[model samples]
Target: MENGSRISGDRRPQVGVAVFLLKSSSILLGRRLSSVGYGTFALPGGRLEFGESFEECARREVKEETGMDVVRVEILTVVNMVALDGPDPTHFVTIIARAEMADSGQSPANMEPDKCAGWAWYEWAQLPQPLFGPLEDLLKGGFNPFAASRLM
Candidate 1:
């Protein structure tokens, strides 16, 4: 524990992808069960694997967590998280991206019951809380996941 700047043993910062899986004007939010962001509503995402691209990670995480196939994934923003509030100062570089469901017939079903309650869509202004750190930072930084007219 580096006291909120970086993880204790790992010197390299963690890189991850958070998806804004959209349906028309609404976006998907999942309740987190991880220790860092327990009980918070945030986008479905996780660490970037060794050889995968950002879009790949987004699609994989979305499908693995929410059981929904996402298509047309695109990068929306890059978030630099420097956590300095707890016993361990952790730093994470998160790639915020967007995508739409590959099939209208498909719906979200929680795949990782241990990590998520379920996934639901919400208007950007009506998103649930308490927000995850990267999500809160993205919101405070004026990042908006809406505006996907194509989804509509």
Candidate 2:
């Protein structure tokens, strides 16, 4: 792989979204309930639905998964993850964006707080682990909102 990046399995080409919602000095993170990365905490986002723009998808996903409306969206990083070990190798482009908070706080609707669990806003420098995969790198890289360059 170029740049020394590695893909572990046969995964299919898919487009996904990720949002880094910030309020006060913390960023929002949601625990996965349904998906390949279930039980792990990840940014609030999902696949882009047909006919929806990437930004729209990001906004909608954040609301659906965390109940917190997105006030503004800004692109932070783009991650391309690949898996080459299955029937059909997969490639995913995860567009990571920063979302400003629109409400005080909220939780997933109709889901058990302990199952879908609850979302948390943590200090950037003290984020908990098991934070999906791509996000872990972004969070650990000292990403600054005003920075011109993104971490590779």
TM-score of each: 0.87, 0.73
Cα lDDT of model 1 by residue, 107-146, tens digit? 8898998988878988876778798988898788776677
- Tens-digit per-residue lDDT, 30-56, candidate 2: 676655556777877878888987778
Model 1 per-residue lDDT at 117: 80
Candidate 2 stretches greater than 4 Å from native: 1-12, 84-90, 104-115, 140-142, 145-152
Minimum summed lDDT over a 10-residue window in model 1 is located at 143-152
